[model samples]
Target: MDKHHSKYQITQLSAGEEYSIELYPKDEVVKAKYIGQGKLEGFGNQHLFISEGKDKNYIAMNDYWLRKKDDGILTYAPISSFSTLRINKSGLGEMLDSENVHYKNLGLRIIRFLESFGEKFD
Candidate 1:
């Protein structure tokens, strides 16, 4: 996998490869792409999920996960299914209301997960 870095860092993962992303400040827009041959599986059986907000604050974007099928690869990104759960468990919406954009409870979980794998976004 070729690794590149700028405002964001890039790494290529192989098929059935799993990775997590957590952006800092909770307001920064982030993007990701999978390079080379392989399948990329993301959180919640999905490749994308936006955090809790009445309006769109951040957009979680990533390359669609791909798998080999009949000598070809099919790609798709599942919808986010965690937003409502996060709001219910931690009152994430209320927490977001308090902070300008620092970090929230559930947000920290994502950050920690990404950091656990030595990934960071600013």
Candidate 2:
């Protein structure tokens, strides 16, 4: 992973790599395994990842709001019905919005996982 200030270009995550993510607030972290790049039914091409637990949860790539630009910059947009989470300047995750709890939680987990790889938000 290449770190540029608070921004990170994640070039280290490989297929089948296992990582942990916080699935819910005050809940135990869950294990997620990267299934590599593939096309999601309605989301086109995206990175596939799945979480392991009592029940299998498939996290769609489209749930991610932070995107890497061509200029190697990290940008964010509210892709879901709400903008519920954010990574603060300190590189810690914080919940800023609360309209959609489910998607927000998943987004938070994904962002934090990316942050572990050195990615950041504005």
Give the candidate number with the greatest lDDT: 2
- Alpha-carbon RMSD, candidate 1: 13.7
| Clashing residue pairs for model 1 | 15-39
Whole-structure CA lDDT of model 2: 0.44
Put down candidate 2 lDDT per residue, 78-107, tens digits, no spaces. Answer: 223221222232322234254568655755
Output the worst ten-in-a-row residue range by lDDT, candidate 2: 78-87
lDDT of each: 0.33, 0.44
Q: Tell me the TM-score of each prediction against the true structure.
A: 0.26, 0.38
Tens-digit lDDT string for candidate 1 (1-122): 21211223233345233333333335222223322221122234223233344532332334433222232222222222232121122343455455646555445554444344444544
Worst 10 residues of 1 by lDDT: 78-87
